[model samples]
Target: MRKNFAVIGLGRFGGSICRTLSDEGFEVLAIDKNEERVNAYAMIASHAAVGDTTDEAVLKSLGIRNFDHVIVAIGDDIQSSILTTLILKELGVNHITVKAQNDYHEKVLVKIGADKVVHPERDMGRRIANNMASSSVLDYLELSDEHSIVEIVANSKISGHTIIDLDIRKKYGLNIVAIKRGMDIIVSPKANEDIRANDVLIVIGTDEDIDRFERKVMQ
Candidate 1:
């Protein structure tokens, strides 16, 4: 389903989200206090305007609270970001997501009523480190603080075993979303499908569960 989005700030982080959302066919209103930045996104965003999100009057004028979702992607200026979020909450916005620079910023954003607080820089670093740590691990994405979706190389443990034989869900709590075997790709693989060493498993579950499964089944 298509949704309306509003992104505040037009720096690197905010600019990237704006472009991606626009490309994905979302109606985006890109806002920034900087005239140059606003103009830069004008050609891309459904609507672009120079406005101070920290100011309630400006936010009210733009009807920002009515958007399906609002992203507080303001950079560096933590004070403005927090103030803007507070106002958005007061105005009864349904959802608000804020970008935090550090742990402290993340805590403050959560306390100030941001529906979701994200630390993109720290999270990306974790992902890169996880991929480097294991040979079988292709990529890692944090589903939450504890859960993750991992792309892992299939090994010899259950090369021809079906899901029934593996007892995957009940025993391991891991769900295999897809499989990439050599040049072939399988989406929504069935329970009857046989696993083979060298196939990549795109599995989703808690980090601990994935590790356990990798040891008992994929090993």
Candidate 2:
């Protein structure tokens, strides 16, 4: 099934999102104030409109609330971003996601009923830094402030052992949610499931526990 997504602000982040969503068979209405930006996405999105998203009248006219998810990806302009987010919330748009420029902006967006807030620049920076700093670690996804689900290669010691033998849940408070072996993915792997060497473990746990597991079992 496809979703109707309204993407506001056609900067790098918003543009990338709009194009990808369209490419993935989503109905995307991409909005941007700049003529050049709107023109850039005109052929890509299902609909491209040049409008000041901060204006409630324009937002209402566009029927933005009808979309399943409205992403306020306004770039650089902090005031416009907050105002647009507020308008989206006031208009009763479900699942509003706003891009936060900084901590202060995030606080404001949260207070205004943004269902989700994203710090793209900071997050991308952290991921790049993490990748640069670690060799064993491949990727990281933040589940919350304290918990994370990471994709890491299994170490030799823990490889070829069943999930029950590893005792990951009890010993480390981590869950081997799945095993990605070559092209196969065993979702919610059985307790007695055997893991092979070179298999990727999609594990979920607290940051500290994940780190410990990584150092001990998944070096």
Q: What is the lDDT of residue 178 in candidate 2?
A: 86
lDDT of 2 by residue, 1-219 (tens): 445888899887777677656654568899998999999999999999999988999998998989988888898999999999988899999788788999999999999899888888655423432332345568877777678888877778888789999898999999888889999999999998988878888989987787677656653
- Sequence-dependent TM-score of model 2: 0.60
Give me the runs in candidate 1 sitting further than 4 Å from their true place.
123-219
Q: Which ten residues in a row have the lowest lDDT in candidate 2?
A: 124-133
lDDT of each: 0.81, 0.81
- Candidate 2 local distance difference test against the native: 0.81
- Over 171-209, each residue of candidate 1 has an lDDT whose tens digit, in order, gives 999888999989988998998999887888888998678
Clashes counted in candidate 2 amount to: 0
Q: Which residue pairs show backbone clashes in model 1?
A: none
Question: Cα deviation in Å at residue 192, candidate 2?
Answer: 19
